[model samples]
Target chain A: MDYLTIIQILDSSLRLATPLLLTCLAGLFSERAGVVDIGLEGKLLAAAFLSGAAAAVTGSIWIGLLAGVAGSLAFSMLHGLASITFKGDQLISGVALNFLAAGLTVVIGQSWFQLGGRTPSLSGDGRFEAWNLPFADAMSKIPVIGPAYDELISGHTTLTYLALLAVPLSWWVLYRSRFGLRLRAVGENPSAVDTAGISVVKLRYAALVIAGVLCGLAGTYLASLAAGFVKDMSAGRGYIALAALIFAKWRPWYALWATLLFGLLEAIGNRYQSIALGDFVIPVQFMQALPYILTVIILAGFVGKAIPPRASGQSYVKER
Target chain B: MNKMPKWADAVLIPLISILLAFFFSGLVIWAIGKDPVVAIKTMVQGAFGSTSGISYTLYYATNFIFTGLAVAVAYHARLFNIGGEGQAMLGGLGVTLVCLAVPWPHWTLALPAAMIGGALFGAAWAFIPAWLQAKRGSHIVITTIMFNYIGAALLGYLLTKVLKVPGSMLTESARFPEGAHLPNFSEILAPFGINFSPNAPANMAFFVALLCTFLFWILIWKTRLGYEIRAYGQSETAAKYAGINPSRIVIIAMLISGGLAGLMAINNVMGEAERLIDNAVEGAGFIGIAVALMGRNHPIGILLAALLFGFLYQGGAELSFWESIPRELVVVIQALVIMFTGALDNMVRMPLEKLFVALGKNKKKEA
Candidate 1:
């Protein structure tokens, strides 16, 4: 690829990867703690709409971001209650949450905006604008990789940096912290964790709550950070995030690579459409389909066994 | 849905769930700024409101029965086949392709081709996920969901680029040849004073659905293969020990799921649209899961559940004729039924069985 095009791809990659990385890592937190999060998509969609509307009304991106997080937290708590407490079927409950979110958010969008869920677009001031690292423009003058590095990697929304930071943070929290160890313990065997004096259910709930907060950030990134909310702007990214979490084998750091790969795949399709490569393109459907195909191939044994945390789908019925 | 005694428990539990769902539905009508009593009256009027409405409800219920059976088949095998939407769409797609491409010298040849095409198309869709699950041990849930998207995207690409007919973004395949269109017999029925309108898409599919449900019931309750599937569903490891191949059962279940849902092609494509539409499935495949679940994955029960969905759909459609509630309110009602029914089904299945057995014993003594 040309230097300018290479730069463009990297820039686009980061932009696309931001949401997947943030949310997949979010998924890791919950699943690794043994709480199944089938409702991540619903949570993401709900957050995106709420934040998009909030940003347009308040004209403050930060407030919008908070709104997204708060909304997602509430959504996650629903997941927590259904799967974590009631011991309902995790997959079924998750599916219900998704159906609920898709309908309820549209209902809200309809009542508030009256535009069939096409929320008001945020102003430039209300968006998290692209930020160039200091001296990065000058660095573009360097050799073969220079242009590629500059255009694709240099300028991006503030969410990209936060998504990057989130990877390490997820790793640190999942592997290094005491709660992380306890959380992992809970996921592996809740009974053991409970026997050890830990409130296995509570810790898992906390993990889900944290995951919910992260999903809020991911949704806000799509709605307020990357662009404005345009109906199903989040689309199936929440589910994609779920796939990414699996592809990464639930490891927090590997989630970065998995998310980035998906982003790159998405960016390739995006670029193909823009470049008028229709004839050469393997149908946009196929391109749009790459992630799921890759996920199936990966999950279907290519990436090796991905044994979920032992207690992943189990409900911890507390002692009477 | 737990298997309980063969009588009153099964009946009472579903009735209770239905009653609860209807009550909640009345509340929804109230929230939407309509009098609950009037809304119920209106819904009843619109659904069975007239002879035509009854015909429409019958037409609607027929599709639900197929979709519900699709879901029930998988549940029997202990698999969650969530790719119903895609499979149903593919069924229509296949049937449409055959109807358009086949230069049938006569109607007899053309109709069968369409039917076979639809079934094979749906079978292929189900096979993809089933094969993946069997060989890879991947959860059917994940692969099926992903396939649902792929199927939708495939249809979208095909429709817009290749299959684009003369229309707006709503267009799909070319219109079917006259030989391929199913006969609308409302005119004939009218002479008997028991008319089902010619305008009504409802036809033999209702009978087909009942036959299929009965077929499924027989397959599950009587056949050795059915017994194997049930065995696997009950305990895969134990079934394996009993010499059943788990993979085979899983693949069979999924194939059955897709094929049953494929019958949608009769109603949705060849029966109704005469060609593909942008959203031919209208989320019927996914809703099938809720239907299957609420029906407790039993054939007779699924038929009942399908009737309820049919009522909501026909009633909801008629509402726009006189009311302001969106057609989507029906989906809301459907979702709530599954939700509330799901909880009660779990709680009531046990006690109802005991009651049914006691009643059966008393009846047997009287006999």
Candidate 2:
């Protein structure tokens, strides 16, 4: 209600939205390239675990980040190998990867650390501390505008800014580049792309790689921001990101808006476990269930239609 | 007619995939400095060594059979109903309401009423997703998955806030009345001089699961509705031309699937826990997808797959206790089985098909 409260809410929303934005963009790339990746949850969990573990072992956040991306990339490649090379069902492959990640993280974590399927609590250089933007202190000295900038826009982890920048970058690559053209072509009509002398497999693999990296960053942010990794730490955020992707209708810019909206909803849910509306109390579980319920509403065509890529979820077999 | 044999497709391929998955699971165990052989031995002994062990295994298998059939029925109609978890949760609520609202005079009377309640609740949960997929062009996978989480939250709310027994510390309902409890296997088989583990949760619900499996077979193969479902699944355009309504079939298939999934609560709630406890469905709903996949969406195959998973679950718990292996490793193995038998079938099939072709050629040359 108050301006300070509004700024605080906005701050928390940005913090929460960063991971969703990264993952939504990740899904955008994969789906746009004709791959339906429901394994985003698995990739996030794997990356988060690897990053947190690497950081704990090596005591360097940079190594942790690299390890996380590499781990996630391994899963992305596995998906590609199954869905593309073997001509397997893409959805099933993704589901398998999710199960693999969910199981292996704990199995390996317990074997190594004996910490009940959790890595050591990250501290010192292992965690990503908030960084103040240049002149944030100076900006805070000014009037209303300065305080807003200082409080709402400054002092986030490095990955948060990267997530924001990824949106425009993803938009440009998807709409303005030559590879983007081929990628879009592959999703809509792989035969046409093949006829144009492009390798559909290569294009899809590239898209999956991009998706892997973005998801890796998302996971890294989750672990580093939270200061440690817990079992199933990604929880259902990856699926939530998937819902956000559908809510955005496979667009990059819309992904930002959708994720932020979900993030705002999440922030509200966190802030208010229960709310009094007249004489009735709306429980927090309903708030937690809002995004999923909203997604079902969207998919039910109450708001608008969500038409996927024409060739999405179809395995392309080359004809002689 | 001039192709490979049926046994190779149905039996050999899955056998090879299971072998491959086991091979990888062994490697993972070895990587962790544990004995793979010992792990395997422990799992086997823990799952089937004693009467008690077998009873637990059967108990877990019963849960899988219900959920697996749920998935298989929907899969025949080309629908991927992944919300069995949520549907089962709603089914638990249904069973709870039935047991608590009315005082049944006998278990036999309560059983049928609970079945109706569970099936209806489960069907209601799945109806919206099926409708959306049928008419609005929404993806069934995403909707069903979202519903699973929503169901969990809803069940949690009900158990904690509305259904909690007065002054009870745990987030669960009071135990069901004595008359409402399903008879366990030991009690049921006592007249036949067949002794089952008295303490095991394996109950009359297992027989109900078997009955459902038989009914599924009849509905899918022996009935007119089954013919329509398979016909619609094979080719929607052909079915449409033949006056079959695709939307109607989709809705019908999902309702049946949801009902079957919901029926699993009989085993978990009324049979085992005797109370609507939180997370009683556990991951049985998700495991049902893997079972349906490995079983190739056939009732018989689902039964076999469910038994296999039940072994892993009961065995894995034993391994975790005796050998310090993480219980989640069971999930890894299950996922691998799914990956190979369901998604990566071509990896094994291609080589085997080539072998069969080569063998046929040699036989022709000799002739």
Candidate 3:
């Protein structure tokens, strides 16, 4: 409505989009390497719980981050072992991993904390505090650009900035790097990559590791958002990230915009119970459902053809 | 070409898988400093020791049977229908509307009408995803996942805005009419001199689930449509060459799957709660995936798997009540079962194949 209100919404949008961006890039790497990872949600949840617990117990955010990443890495490796090494159905493996994360987090959390599957709330260094960019105060005097820069671009957790940075980094790693070309090749046709002497299994494992690290960061950021871990804290954010990945058509730069859009929708939903246009009123639930609905429509090829990698979801088998 | 005998494939694999799952679950409990043996004993006693426990287990199994059959049917056509949660929720809405539209003279007439309504709504929820997958080259898995979220949102809006009982803070519809009540297990068994727990929610829907299981077997094995579905699942190209329409098979299989998922509402919503509430399906839809996986997508196998899960659920509840072990322990067990049975089948199968091959060689030497 007003300028300040709009600024506030945009600020929160960036904050909400941080986890999505990180997780989306994570999915991008895994999917681009011919490994379908529906386990991203599980990874996020595990990371969130472990990070929160570590932060609470150790009183160190860095240790929490490490623990979170380790948790996600374990899941990613499990997924790789099942879908890559065992050549099992990738989707089923992901589904199992999700359930495993969902169950294990609460079970372990309840045992350790005895707070009904919640980590103790963190304060001070136990959480990631927002960092204001240099000259934020001075820039506020510049009117439109100042407030916009200060509010929209500046003053977010270090993870938020890293998430934004990852967009370019992912693009470079996916398109400009030598490994990127080979990784893309593996996803499109693993046989060709194999013929070229690149081990498809190794490349996929590497991609999953990268995905695991990114998911770790995302999960830690989520714990930081709540200042602790709650039961099922990831709360479908992983699925939303996957939806954003599909919406972006697996491109890194497009991923930023897609996640931002979804994030904006979420911010708006949180801010308003409903939007009224004259006599017509839109319920908040519609806003909550819009991202998924749009993804379904995009997937149905109404918006554009979102063709996935050919070898995606298929386990590669070497010919004897 | 078969590495193992038919009996082993049908029974041995699942038996071993379940054992592995329970073993791992025990390890988790031990890690948490709890006695896994005591937990298991408690679960067994709680789920089956009393008439109430058995009834509750049966009640939960009723929901699982419907959803498990839903997943199994779709699996036959190679369509993974993960939107069972949404479909079941919508099915509850359908049951609610049917039951509330008029005071039924009797549940005998109401049951069939509610079944139709539930199936229709559930099928309708699944139709778009099925059509997209069939015609537009969209991935059914992603689309179905999206539909689950959408279905939840739709149900939430309907409950808060339209279905909530007036003057009540709870986001649930008014209770169904007296005649719409389905007879519980106690009432159903009373005439036969069988004493059951009157407080248990287990109802005639359990019988309906059993009937559906029988019907599912007939549909999958005895019908031309089932043959076509299996053919399509095995190889779409070969099925096309054999003059079977892939799109038709996909649509029909998904419809059947969605309909079965919807039928779960009859157990949880109509039979148990007698009111439509938010999250009525709970996680049964997702559990259906695990059930179908453990069952190997067979109707009889699904029935057994559903019963196992029902026991776990009832037992988990008892564990939480008695030992405070947390009910999510059951979910952890379920995850392990799914992982070992579905995702890591080769891990078990390879060793068994080797054992069987070695045994066959020994037999040849003896001969």
Candidate 4:
């Protein structure tokens, strides 16, 4: 409850929220374009592995980011090929990508690193170093704002700031741009967009490609956090992002708040694995389960309904 | 009116898909600087070369059969119940509770009681999601998947806090009583004068899985409930027009699905591990999705698909043990199978359809 403790918790929350924020935006891009991407988890995992491996091999953080994003892009294209071009079941395609990523990452990692499905730990330039604001030290001596700025706002990996910046950027692009208008139209009514000669397929694929890049950043952030890649490092964060997306009701601005809330919950769970509540001890497992349980409750109509795009999960057939 | 025969749809498509998956998997192995042929041969030999391997293969197959049927039953009602992993975890807890509540004199006496406990617990877990979907318009896919994570955390707590053996560091319950252990394949085959590996975990639960498959076939194809489920799956509006209540079918189908998923605990807990432990369900719940798809959501097809996955799993273990190929390759292979059989079916079917149409046109010209 103290000021410093609160700042410390906020710091952890910000770190945890970064991955979720990037991924939620990723899901936002795909879902808004009429694609249900359950494979967000797969893309994140693939990117994490690729990023870690590339950084380890090349000893350059920038190369790692490039390789990671490229890997995610390849998978995204595969998803597009299956769901868009083949007119296959979108859900099935997403699920398959998840499986493929889970398997391929470990297989390649073991072969390359020989460390039981984990990448070599990165150091120095191989990982993103924290950025210190120019006036952080000087400002820390001033007053409450100074201390708060230094403690809570100044130090984060470069990707964290990028993830935060992405929210308003996403909102601007989604609401204020012509391409965004076309993208939203394709999701809601592909036929109408088709009639307008806007090329629904191209718009949707473009959305997925953007999603791939964001997922790439999310994966890279995860790798940068630990400075290495472990097996299944994405864990269930991708699913958590999907839940966050639903919690946000598919809006870009709301995604930031939702992911932060989820991240805060996780931070508290990590800080207090066991807590004394009056005479009873609260288990951390309950805290860990809270986000999922809340999602179920929200979806059950305790809160307002979260409606997806009408054209989602459907293979748009032009002639029919 | 039709160029392609129904039999081709049933058999040839899956056959070609599996072939294509293997072909691609071979290329992957080749890319990794390994011999695909030797790798595959090793997998085959490992899965079936000995009585022990066969027992293990059949044992893994039993788990897949239960979970596969769980998915298939729900699929028939147009529900994608991805919570089988969670349900099976809860089922393990239920089985543990039943086994520990009182010491039973024999496996036969404990089996039915444990099955009932597991089924009810799993059904109860699924009821909320089904209700939400049926009455509140919650998407089943999202809720069920969310439930899997919740179920995992819940099970983790239960095993660590309530079920752990006293003074033990591991997060697992104490071993079941002697009489609670199911008879293994060796014991079962002894009366027939056949030799089998006593060490293998294959047990009476395999028969239970087979019975469930038979029951699933009857429920889906032979019974009125089955007709309602299929009708509902095909066209919800049409089913409603025909007087089948959508909500009722949804709840009933989910209940059956949860029950089938729960039964998987019998194979893993009482039959193999003989102790309730964390992660006992492993990834079998997700694998059930692939099995259901490859099986075409049919009982016979489920049996075949389950066996195929069982082969891959056992073979993959062998491959990792003998060759440098990683065990994760098994998952890659499974994913490929799912992709081809489920998502990319049109890739194979479109060409086959064109060929059949051409042949039919030639026949018409001759006539």
Whose DockQ is greatest here?
Answer: 3
- Candidate 2, chain A: TM-score against the reference: 0.98
Candidate 1 CAPRI category: acceptable
How do the candidates score on chain B by TM-score? 0.89, 0.97, 0.98, 0.98
Residue ranges of candidate 1 with Cα displaced over 4 Å = A136-150, A225-228, A274-281, A317-320, B1-42, B104-112, B161-171, B185-188, B318-323, B343-367
iRMSD for each candidate structure, in the order shown: 2.4, 0.7, 0.6, 0.8
Per-residue lDDT of B252-300 in model 4, one digit per residue for the tens? 9999999888889989988999999889998998999999999999999
lDDT score, candidate 3, position A284: 92
Global lDDT of each candidate: 0.79, 0.92, 0.94, 0.92
- Candidate 2 CAPRI category: high
Q: Which digits, one per residue and each the tens of the lDDT, describe model 2 over residues A14-126?
A: 99999999999999999999999999999999999999999989988779999999999999999998888888988889989999999999999998899989998899999
**What is the DockQ (computed on Cα atoms) for candidate 1?**
0.36
Worst 10 residues of 2 chain B by lDDT: B1-10
What lDDT tens digits, residue by residue, belong to model 1 across residues B1-367?
5345545455666677677767876676676566767766777898886777887888788888888999888888888888888899899888888888965566567766776787788878999789878878888888888888888888888898888865565657887887776655484476678756568777655676788889999999999999998999999899999999988999988888898888778877887788788888887887787788788899878988889888888888866456755555675567556655552354455566666667877889999
- TM-score-wise, the better of 1 and 2 is 2
lDDT of 3 by residue, B13-45 (tens): 888988998899999999999999899999999
Looking at model 3, the pairs that clash are none
Model 2, span B1-367: residue lDDT tens: 5457999888888889999998998888998889999998999999999878898899999999999999999989888888999999999999999998887889999999999989999999999899999999889999999999899889888998999998989999988998998999789888999988898888999999999999999999999999999998899999999999999999999999999999999999999999999999989998998999989888999999999999999999999999999999988998898789877988888888889999999999999
DockQ, model 3, C-alpha based: 0.89
